[model samples]
Target: EGKKSLNFIEQIIEEDLQKDYKKEDLKFRFPPEPNGYLHIGHASSICLNFGLGERYDAPVNLRFDDTNPTKEEQEYVDAIKRDVEWLGFKWAKECYASDYFQQLYDWAVEMIKNGDAYVDSQTSEEIAEQKGTPTKPGIESPYRNRSVEENLDLFEKMKNGDTPERGHVLRAKIDMTAANMLMRDPVMYRCLHKNHHRTGDNWKIYPMYDWAHGQSDFIEQVSHSFCTLEFLPHRELYNWFIEKVSKPGDFEPKQREFARRNLSHTIVSKRKLLQLVEKGYVDSWDDPRMPTISGLRRRGYTPESIRKFADSIGVGKRENLIDVSHLEFCAREDLNKIAPRVMGVLDPVKLVITNYPEGEEEWLDAENNPEDESAGSRKVPFSRELYIEREDFKESANRKFFRLTLGKEVRLKNAYIIKGEDVVKDDEGKITEIHCTYDPKSKSGSGTEESLRKVKGTLHWVSVKHAIEAEIRLYDRLFTEETPDGVKDKEYLDFVNPESLKIVTGYLEPSLKDSKEQDKVQFQRIGYFCVDRDSTSAKPVFNRTVTLRDSWAK
Candidate 1:
């Protein structure tokens, strides 16, 4: 056995351990704002932190950076917890930024008294205008020189909701001419009168993410605060704020950046996803077409598949767009090993065996999953009349067509060899039924020589009388464009795939009737599918997880 190579993030930890870092001092945290459901993009961060926690046997806290009250909600907080737990990682503690509001406010007061922070009375627009670009230094607010007594009094009034929401903000008194724009007196707290989800109306002001994030990590003593690459510039401010609030000897949490993994043809932005839900583009946040963790779960994605994907891609220093096909490929691979094989025809065409007796039926032995020996077998009813895929049969086809064609032989999966003889069509020339003759001695799994005969194609079928009808929802990419967000001229919504979902009635084997919600199965030659939550005794519904192969490949 060989030791696994470390990713860049792991290498950083290893390097730190070799230097001033202690093995036991390694604590980590996954901080997410409870503004929306966790998306596929968050999956990487969750896996990385949780993976490191497992690697070092360190405590990893599930911390909510729930600073703003307007957008944050307890619903999203609960959803986030469910998502992380579903990924199979347990958090050491459930913490929230709201829990540290009082401490943070106290620290802000101390910073003000020390002249490291001040209350800025400028409107948000005016403040933004003062934040000079990359080459230019920002203009310091006139109030930046306010007396500590005046600043303290004004900030206290702001916290008490006595000021207008846009009137005042607490800013760190860092260098106004610093090269990093984020270091130029960034806002620490903003006066928001909205009620906090956890604190209720206890406090009327909220700390900015930049202010609360690093300090919360510092307070919890998290050794590494890993954030996406966009936060790279904020590391200075992150450290500075921690320095202001910490003693010289205290351990500080360092903010490190990793490139975000983007999925093609999908938007991970919560704003856009919210628009999708609000505009009726999707049913809800958990719509199967969405990339949210709940959406993927409802869409039949197994936790094992998602974790495998996150682990396989690892973490990268540079951002790259991953084709959704690879994710689908992962799902197919995982489902193949676990999903029970069943017969289903989404677009069925009736096939009547001419020589077989009309009322006769036999229960044949069918393997549940050939990939697993212990999966064993089940009885699948075979009858005179069966349904196969409409595309499987053609009155005539070229030599390349291995499926059922007139005068050609094809084996019915788990049944007998059948030769297409004739077809019955409507007056409009649409195929209504297909008639075939089966070799009785050619029953599959029988020791008879005819049963051992080879065929170019094998087609899955369900007995017409014993089959159960189901509603199948075939899912596709949400956006038609490869990079929906990259287009400058059009919005991501403009590229929404109109045919992303297609509902069809399917003929499924009788055994599937007993399948409960969330039960996954491979529909033999069709694809992988799971019983949706909408299933009932009268009508079972299935969601197509992914195609058996990538059909969209060029």
Candidate 2:
């Protein structure tokens, strides 16, 4: 095998391996707060951690940082697990921060006894005010000098629910004058008198994220705790808590930072996504227009496509907006090799063969996927009357137009060559049906000389008698702006594209009647689509994944 170039995160690991870290000591983790569905941004991190595990033959843990009960839920936890597993990686252990709450509480008590932590009686706002600015020293809390006995008693009261929810909080006794604001006596625990998803109502006080994260990593003996660059400042505090909890010569985890890759036209913030849901901008978390993993899945994006996207973008020291087309390109590249080609006319206009027998129909052999011969072929029904895209025809078109028009011959895919003769219109002058005549000798794939006749266009169509109707959902970008949240004075929701979703009934070839939920297909001349989970025997529904090519390209 060739020596592969390493990403910066891998280089950090290599540097560690050269130092005191052994290959056996390599352990990584993907810790996500279970508050919402995992988005495309999280995919990069998941791939990074799990990719590292695969590269080093180490174990990766799936740990839910479910420290906040007010926002976190078991549904989100289960969704995180499902999304991770769907991305084709397995965790060595399924862990949660709440699992070590008792251990963290014990450590806090020990820190109080050693004067390393003190219970503050001020409200959270007061504590924040005292944190001060980076250039100025923070004011010390009035309860900074509380006795160990009194601190322990108050901490117990906070834990026992005897204190009001905002009454007392435990703060690490760090330097108040530290330049790093996070180091200025950061709150380690706060009172939250709410029922937890996992540990229902047994405790009142919960540990803060900074207090729980590094300690959980230490407890799990995670060798490298790689988080987003936002946590670079938290590294000092992460280590401080780890040092206070670990004894001399004990395992110490290293914290590293990586930049987040944001997708164009999409806001990766969970809070904003929740607003989109609550504001009725989207139907649900798994709405096909959403950027969430389940949403992508429902939109016919393959697991391999997502992983390829993550790896192609890779990790970096700086963040940038990745054009959503690149993601669509990845989906097209994968779906092309797998998704079967089917004919589904979204805007149907009738076409009649004037000479062909009206009562007769035939099943024609159609290649399932021209890109994959092993995918075999399927039978598509054809008859005298067919439905083609309403935009595929014109009474008179210039030289550049390749589709059907008066006196211009075109091939019916997998069937026969036909030429437009006349049109039947309604009282309102709308072209109701196009009348055409077929050359009987030009059946596709037949060994006749006429069958090989070159035509400027090949139109996909479904037999009028055999066509199945399906509810087709055409989706566009959810937001109009490339960076909806980046603009000043405008909420992301203000940029929501009102035309993101358009629903219509489509006429599909009979070969698609047997398609099950999640089955993907390239609807010839239209776009890629998938059978939605909501599809039933009587009412089939399909979601448009992406267009055949980048439509937004300039």
Candidate 3:
């Protein structure tokens, strides 16, 4: 039986509804910075915000927190939208912080004219020195007492590109000795004479993230502002700013924090991922081994599997590292019922069925996916010459070995049973091939008594004459450490997994000739795989997402 789907976020929404928080009044926003590609951590947030919208019958706005133009880009913005839509959620309206630049500027002016804010002349170093440690009270800035009229004029001048130095800043005139240090007169605006991606170079000033985030949510009428735990301290500052800026009875969006998802044995930091791409350590941002959403998609991960992972992890207040195996488990669960079973050999060893007639071929019926009865079956080519996994045969046999060994019997998947007669080796004593003889009466699904005989092992095989040659890329975790970002003293790069990706040539069943880019399937007894963007009609390329469960790990 399927288990119930429950997450802490859903429970919160449910209680809110029970307490008369009107369903139609609840609104959520997925506010991403768009400075980097979306990672698995962001997927959790995406599911929460959009899932709330779905449950409440409310709209979820997709807002880009494009506060820092230097780091943000149109490419990132487009990628984020693509990822969200792929995850099966639609944004009610597209929003950008740049769209409210004028309103934010007007609010800054109001603050300056009311003596609640002022233009500061302290350099960044001087400001830092004044902003003391948590154990100490901060010293007031020299310009803290500037007259309201003078401060307003200075703010306008600053906005008009009059200040080119860091000392000139517009700061909220909050307490400098507050216990919560974020309220110690945070900077509201900075003078940056840079071109904005959306607003262009019409103004030289930009609102700080702390100042713009809450008001933007207010302007959009968002009822809930969801963020990660790192922003908890800033929440107090956020609510304070919103209270002072908006009317008393107006709805102020509440800020709630949840512990961001962290996966074991994987580094999800954008900085580290960028380093891997720029330093040529990896192919690109979408490399199959990367943890980025685009990377996972390119690696053959389905959106359903990823969303299911987010739901399974649930929402929590405490932080913990989740095993990457849980993610693999979700993918396997999703693909088990969908992916068609196919035959492929990575390390091929030639097998010659001496008892079978030469230059003859037969069609053998193979179930497409035994897990799905409606999938039916397909015919596979079977012939005298076949290729099996190299590991399936042994010249020096062991007593417990169930695979093909000298004089041992084994069954070919979807074909007749065979017995290994002898093995062939080169001068270096490396086994090159195996000789076997087939029992015609033991063909699979032949409805004969011999066909029902049990064999210890069944191996997937491809006819040498009808097989398709292809390139396969196998990917592993990118990091060797459990917490690559936790150790401050050691560089994260030191934990890089050197064997993250391996590319090799392999042979697949002839049915794969029709496979195109992004098509996924399960290589029988091996793993689930996807056709890569690099696939060609002549030589298709595939990526192995994850391997099937085997007892080796046990």
Candidate 4:
């Protein structure tokens, strides 16, 4: 009851329905340009579109707003499809703006012949200078009044590849002194000799994003065209283009804006992300520490958790910056329910039980996942010799310390109670091993009275003989400062976290030998981890997604 109600977008849709808008008229889309992999921000949009579709029993289309040939790629398109499916959403149809290129070109020709558009031959700089700032009125291009027949012939030649890239641009005829600068004769088409990812070199002219976006939505009969707040000013131009091109009875898609999701501690801009990858600030686009969806997936984020997060944040009209911990909390919450707990000794310290029978070994049953009964249990080998986490042992522990220490008795999880007796060291005096004696009567799960004995310390361990060597990667925040964008004077690279990624060869339970990539597991008393894409059958590598407690860090 204490939580906030549903967001404004939901309210708007509900109100629309109440006012007699048919459910059949509702169609939404998540249109992304196939220029790069989808990021967490895109995840929010996907959930919004698909979630609304499910709620209203409407269909949502997955459209590629790919208009720039220089940046778009087929690889990105494939990856986007994979990501959307992975997030548990199915699109009604997969459409590309390029599919409507011919229709858009015909419409542009119509506009030129009707005196609503013209071709401008001015340089990009000159056009920008004339299209003045938000507060200033813009100056019209010199070619604004070009004769209709001449403009059409030139446009046809431009499409036929007779013109060089940027040699001429088709601009919509609009008021130059409009309050919104975007409406000041916005560029509709441009000549590009480069090959399109989908269209190839079939045509030399392509429509700009503004001209192509609204028309695509109108053609698909979208009822509500949603966009981030940055496009608020461009809404006027988007609607104007629709009114000029749409036939009678065609849906005039309403444009609605919502604030974009901004996290307090990360950078989401593709350009900055690209810089980070190119500069070696991260391993690749899918680096566990990066914000891309693939990166989050590689970092052990579950689709269910991310969807829950998007649902929780909901849709809002005003801007807000969410704390990164909220995302971590959601991920941790989801992993805690499904991840199988296993023993791993990152910093191994040898423990020898002097009182146990020589060369004795036992198979102790450990719960795989306490949260899910269907997960059952697994056998963990316990023997006279075991390896515990180095952090679990202490030569000199404080009064509040609840882990293993000299002269202290602690419970070996799924095993017997053991008391630290002594330590063995090399010539340099650094302790190499700990000597302890197991209490014969304190065998775990045994019916004996001593089996019920309680101890403050409980430690996880691996059988020294059954342990598998593994390379574990520990990741931290990518940037040292919480607000990477806040640093204006110094480059964001200066704040790159030097210790963001740490690699260590550790001893893991042999059960993990065949774990597949992206498989998630929890290291007892450590953290949740996922098998990295870089892992191979010969060497299983894992990335520490996040620790059990937020307080622990290297």
Candidate 5:
């Protein structure tokens, strides 16, 4: 059978193919502005473009639209490349709009010679005022009709570093009264004396994004230029530049816009994210709470999970806000199949096996991943003294409570069944320890009737003597409000969740002592976690990836 039904973009490509568009000519490009790190929203674009390339066996170039030297940096460029590769994509070529600086300058000069563009000496505010609103027609700039020769001289002067910054901007001499505001004399080039990350001080003026993007696509021979819906209005201008620059038989890149993937309870705006980093709202760009690719990776989110999420959401034309829980659900689904099952106690309380030998210890067989039988099993050390979640026990709980309580029987996962008998408290009346007795015949997986006995609750425990102490970071949504950015007259930062991150010491199974950074595992009955980069041999750290169940809604 043929492949699955196509998305709108695929249908467009299919129609083009019927019109004699060669499958081999179906080249695409993913262009990212290197002003900030790549976020989850960008991942969808990456997957779409790269996945198309894979499906058609075509080439997809990774292009950095680093035209605005004021904000673009080499660090951001490197991060973008790293993110793409980490997502299991290989670009046909790594290209940058800055690479076509000379070609873009030459094209601008041609436009000036053709009397289709001119230099305007208007402040940004004046330019904005001239543009007018959607319902109203814009007034023409006073300098719109400058002679081609004069505009040429001024442009050359601007390029030669003689023009003051923002004193004169090269504008395409399009209709001022055009229905689409972007078509009304858009700025094509501007003078900025800043040092470019790639070009350094070689050029004093830079082409605006509208001028650079389409031309770069045309120069690279990209067949399709995919962008978010915000750029839908800019498509006309994108084509206009291609028309002005294209030579005979030169391929014109097609611009298609898709709705941006917006996640609830978080802001994906680079400016706001930067504010969070600069103002110390987060530890860094890789803070687990961040929606950045690096942050997700650091938080134990596997590339498989993110790719699955991108696929599950698919491509759409209408804007929609996806619940963050959906993303967590995907992570849980992927982690369940592969992540090893281990025991961890985030809030530890000592459990003393009163009837067991005090100095004796035994190793019990434990399944690594029940969903993946091939993952087999491992030996977990069990001893008289063990640590369980402090909340798992109480002085007395109702019959509805399945966990440990006085006179209640609970099975220790991979070990024997134990009954809580007594509790020891400190001077503050807080239960410090619980005394219990175990039925040795009830050891898990043993071929005995006692082993088949069922209990209302199964508790995961780590032997206190062999437990590895680890620093655990529990993360939640960065914002309390689901639509923080949608609120009128309110700062998105005002909705920042103060309890987004919580740090606690945890006791882990001994097998995790050798865990390396990025290794993912599921803490039985707790959550999925990833070994953190900050982990060391002496002191390991883990970031809670997601809970065992969806608790946010509850």
Candidate 6:
């Protein structure tokens, strides 16, 4: 039997199946801390964890490791769920670490009673000082060997709001002399009177992430815990907490780490992303220039393209900076097949057909999408007075220039061929209007012999009388440097591209007047654009998603 090749994680699952694990027992989870909006880096993780569940026919839980009350919020929780669903994956259950507060507390008490944990009354700075580097053994805390009864009393006091915030902390009674600095009696819980987003102010002490993460997975009976490479060091602490709480015959959730996908020229750290938002470096988390999931969606990125990009990158053990172009390429590839083509002149120049009849209009056939036959076609209105791209015309040019140069003929897209004769300029010698003569017999698809006549250039135009006015936002890369965050000496904001966004009014075909928000279309010779949510019936706004090609590479 032919079988698909498996990733390392898949291979691990298959190996587990051969040993004792049942296919029905295969449960996966994607646990994201609800501190900030999910970014493109998180999209990769979402796809991976959800993809594993689909491949194994298992249930995947959407768990929020909302341990810190100071940062976690319902807004972030809602955004995370929306992002996960937007990526086209459904979780089996939406769980939160705070939901298991009582159970986790009871387990912490059990560990204390078992003489495997103790209360340490030390400042965070003091504790950090005692936690020696990897090259040296950490010094044991002064209160490490307190009797179990006293430790329990202190922990209860800490939880009952009797202790000041940061007065004391509960530490796992692991080896302080252990070579792994994280294993050297790490803190399990801390005193924080802050109100939790979910649990409220019912308790004072909260379990640390290392303490809550694995236990929550165990409580849900998750079989496979997938995390990024940064959590690899914490995996030891994750298992240590799980080992103390697990009962015999219970399924212990296994932790496996994969490298995080780093998109070039952008920062994905939630803290840094929050900084970007708070500092007003970007418009918002959903700004098109941002690498956030909402930003991508607003910028015309489809779920299919993102999922395809994740698949293309695949699962790797070592982190690598992926070129942002690959993502753009995927978006372009997906959009090219479905996006309807429309004529929109960003920099409009009036073009008059000198010989054409005045006060006359005609509708010409134009395909909605040339790549898809079933997309069908639509009628685009044309007339003697039309608007073409300002750069599409020149008074005089070499033979190599195929556009609307003097005495040079060019085909009007879906219309008749025309020859430029004269141009009207302003006082400043700026070209204002161009005059051209159209070949009446050379109408496109007319089936007449003149229709077969080939021109060196073709131009897209919109009838002046019927054209719709639109605000076009041209977006470029957010950062000018290839790796803005990689530079150690400078701030990431220093590399922000000042001209990342350019706004201009454009003339579009009348068919686009009714375009609703998020409607994607190709602006003929321009680029792929998405109808902005700010659009209204009177005026429409469009965001340039990506250019016709790799404009940056050029």
Q: Which residue window of length 10 is worst by lDDT in model 4?
A: 545-554
lDDT tens digits by residue: candidate 5, 218-256:
998888888999999999999988999887787688999
**Residues 410-513, candidate 3, lDDT per residue (tens digit)?**
99999989999988889998777789999999999988999999989899999999999999998888888879878889877888889888888888999899
lDDT of 2 at 177: 99
Task: List the candidates' TM-scores in order.
Answer: 0.99, 0.99, 0.97, 0.97, 0.98, 0.98
lDDT per residue for candidate 4 within 85-126, as digits (tens), equals: 999999999999999999999999899988999999999999
Q: In model 3, what are the clashing residue pairs, if there are any?
A: none
Better of 2 and 3 by lDDT: 2
Q: Which regions of candidate 4 are displaced past 4 Å?
A: 1-4, 552-554
CA lDDT, every model vs. true structure: 0.94, 0.94, 0.88, 0.89, 0.93, 0.92
Candidate 6 residue spans exceeding 4 A from truth:
1-4
Candidate 6, poorest ten consecutive residues by summed lDDT:
1-10
In candidate 6 the C-alpha lDDT for residue 444 amounts to 93
RMSD of each candidate relative to the true structure: 1.0, 1.0, 1.8, 1.7, 1.3, 1.1
Model 4 alpha-carbon miss at residue 368, Å: 1.1
The local lDDT score (0 to 100) that residue 131 gets in candidate 5 is 96
Q: Which residue pairs in candidate 6 have backbone atoms (N, alpha carbon, C) closer than 3 angstroms, thus clashing?
A: none
Which regions of candidate 3 fall more than 4 Å away from where they truly are? 1-8, 18-20, 165-167, 550-554
Put down candidate 1 lDDT per residue, 1-554, tens digits, no spaces: 59889899999999999999999999999999999999999999999999999999999999999998999999999999999999899999999999999999999999999999999998999999999999998998999999999999999999899999889999999988999999999999888888888999999899998999998999999999999999988898888888899998999999999999999989988778999999999999998999999999999999999999888888999999998998999999999999999999889999999999989999999999999989999999999999999999999999999999999999999999999999999999999999999999999989899999999999999999998999999999999999998999888989999999999999999999888999999999889999899999799999999989899999
